[model samples]
Target: MSINQIQDEIIDEFSLFSDWMEKYEYIIDLGKHLPLIDEQYKDEEHLIKGCQSRVWLHAGLEGDKVVFTADSDAVITKGIIALLVRVLSNQPAEEVAQSELYFIDKIGLKEHLSPTRSNGLVSMVKQMKLYGLALHAKS
Candidate 1:
């Protein structure tokens, strides 16, 4: 699916919950299902800098698409990244780099998160786009 389509799906999913507590639980559940990142990429180089928790993100090009893999020490952070990856991963590099991730606001994720977590989320998006830019150059 395109990034916007995926974001809309997520928005739809989040809208099903009646309250923020249920949304939090759903986010945690999403974290449980996030694909594990390779142990080799868990080094300092892949670790996201601004996150309060340890988050490692790695991106690679598969043909013209950028594929992302990530892990986070915190469950909620892990789920947040999982949401991002679901929207951005396996997409064309330029598209990933330029995509507008409106789902964060549409789903009210930013308002719901702690300030530090929100910063971490922004950092994660920046890193992903950086990877996209670099990978696009290579391709």
Candidate 2:
């Protein structure tokens, strides 16, 4: 599926929850399902700064697409990265870089997060796009 299609599926999934508590539970569930990054990739360079908890994201180019692997010390934060990776990974570099990610607002994710976590989300998106850009240039 395309990036937007995957994002739309997520939006549909999050829309089922009626309240923040339920939504958080769903997010934590998603985190639980996130395929973990390798131990080697979980080191210093992949660690995302500005997060209250440790979040490590590693990206690699496969053929013409970019694939991402990530993990986090926090459950909710792990879910947040999982959502991003679901939409962004295994996609063309240009698509990943230019992704609109409208689902963040549609699912009320940004508004529900604390100020610090919100900043971390922004940083995560920035880093993902930067990875996309780097891979795009190489291609």
Question: Which pairs of residues clash in candidate 2, taking residues 3 or more apart in a chain or in different chains?
Answer: none
lDDT of 2 at 98: 90
lDDT of 2 by residue, 1-139 (tens): 9999999999998888889999999889988886769999988888876546777889999999999998888888888888888899999999999988888888998653445554366677888999999899999
Residues 54-106, candidate 1, lDDT per residue (tens digit)? 77888988999999999888888888888999999999999998999889898
TM-score of 1: 0.91
Off-target runs (Cα >4 Å) in candidate 2 are 112-119
Worst ten in a row by lDDT for model 1: 111-120
